[model samples]
Target: MTPLLELRGLGVRYKGAVAPALEGVDLDLAAGERLAIIGESGSGKSTLARAVAELLPQTVIQQGTVAWPGLDQKARNGRDIGFVFQDPASSLDPVMPVGDQVAEVAHANLDMDWRAARRLAVELLDRVRLPEPALLAQAYPHQLSGGQKQRVAIAAAIVARPRLLIADEATSALDTIVQAEIMALISALVAEDGMALLFVSHDIALAANLADRVAVFRHGRLVEQAATAELVSQPRTDYSRALLAAHLGLHA
Candidate 1:
């Protein structure tokens, strides 16, 4: 079977930057497979996500081929890519009711009428296990907690059932309990839909729980990639060892 996402010699650099945020990175994500990218801040993890989604900013220069099944080469927005941003509150509009914001995506992409679109939004919210989907549908971002907002984000991302979902540090802003909840929710959704997942996070333990394979990044370079069990037990690079040690120290 063809891969769901493929990146070859991927590199990104913003205009007038001293160095590229990412360089010479290659990755493949198969349908129903989970891949986690772990690295320190500014290690190009998020950059890789944006590049895959074709959402990089105007000032950035990209050199690579990102092929997705059924992607509209003419209109990049129609591609089968969904994104769950790190900060839920920032990703949502303060004024619009969360449901309406989510419904808009379905309306725009799926061409559903307003009523049907709204119903789909509510259903998605409920699917994410939000309490009182109808009531929450009427609420704004400020009315929801951080965890609830993240749920709403997840709901919106999967509303269209995209083939590939890219979550960039999605659980980092939530409390530990909520983080666990969100991770479980994400995992369940991936299993439910069988969509490919590209998860980017600095939390090794959390990522390990959800990923089949782990790819370690260092200074924008992909230094190591392996199965989660193998990589955790025997990291090939010094950087991977340091990252694993840091995570171990936190719990030790």
Candidate 2:
């Protein structure tokens, strides 16, 4: 089957940046497959995610292709792709009621009326395991905890039921316990909906635990890509080994 997403010799450079954020990077994610993009800050993993979602700023000079052979029509941002940002605070509207924020996606992308969209939004809030879906729906971002805000963000993301979910460091801002909960929620939702997952993270351990495959990136380039077990057990590059070592040391 055609891959859900494909990138070939992709390069992205900011208008006046000294170097490209991403260069000559080629990668693929299959439908319903979970793939992690592993890298530290400025390694360009997030750039790759934005490029896939076409969320990059217009000032950036982009080269090469981001194609979806699996999609018959042009892929849309909210309808074909669901993105959960690292910081839910910035991603969500502080003034809008959380429920309507989610309902808006369904209203816009899925073309549902307000009543149905809101009803579906409540169901989604429940699906994401939020407390008191009906009551909490009226709350604003400031009213929710970090974990709860993240859960609301997740509800908004999947409300339209996009085929691909690009979680750009989605769990990074939460505490360890909350991070695990979010990860479990993401994993369960992906499995249930069969949505392709692009889990971008700096944590190799989290990647190993959640991804079927891991693609290691460094200095804006893809260093290596392999099955999760293979990459974890026998990393081909020194950088990969160092990352694994760091994770081991952290847990040790």
Candidate 3:
């Protein structure tokens, strides 16, 4: 079967930056498959995700193709591709009720009226395991904890039932316990909905735990990619080895 997502010679450079954030990278994610882009800061993993989602800023110069051979039409950002950014505070509207924020996506993408969209929004908040979905629906971004806000963000992302979910460092900002919770939530949702997942993170161990495959990146280039087990057990490149060693050290 055709891959749900394909990238060919993907490159991105901020207009005034000295170097490109991403360069000549190629990757793929199959339907219902979870692929993690592993890289430290400035390594371009986030750039790759944004490129695929076409979420990059207007000033950036992007090259090459992000094609969906598995779908007939080009993907739209909020409709077909759901993105959970690292910071939910910035992604969500502070003034709007969390439910309304989520409902807006469903209302816009699913073409539902506000009342119906709001009902679906509460249902989604419940699905994300938020406590007292009805009450939380009225809460604003500032009212909820970091994890709760992120949960609201997740609810918004999946409200349209998108074909793909790109989680760009979705758990990085949270505490360790909350990180695990969010990871579990993401894993369960992906499995339950069968949406292709593009998980971008610096945490090799987390990537190994959640991804079918992990693609290592460095300095805006793809260093290597392999099955999660294979990559963790026998990394091919020195960089990959170092990354694994670092993760081991952190947990040890």
Residue 153 of model 1, lDDT score = 93
What TM-score would each prediction reach against the true structure?
0.95, 0.98, 0.97
Q: Give the per-residue lDDT digits (tens) of candidate 2, residues 36-136.
A: 99998999999999999999999999999999999997679888999999999999999999999999999999989999999998999999999899999
Native-to-model Cα distance after best TM-score fit, residue 95 in candidate 2, in Å: 0.7
TM-score of 1: 0.95
Candidate 2: residue 169 Cα off by (Å): 0.6
Q: Go through the candidates in order and give the C-alpha RMSD of each one to the true structure.
A: 2.1, 1.4, 1.5
Q: 137-218, model 1: which lDDT tens digit per residue?
A: 9999999999999999999888778777889999999899999999999999989998778999997887778999999987
Better of 1 and 3 by TM-score: 3
TM-score of 3: 0.97
Compared to the true structure, candidate 2 yields what TM-score? 0.98
Error of 3 at 71 (Å): 0.6
Give the whole-model CA lDDT for all candidates, comma-separated. 0.87, 0.93, 0.93
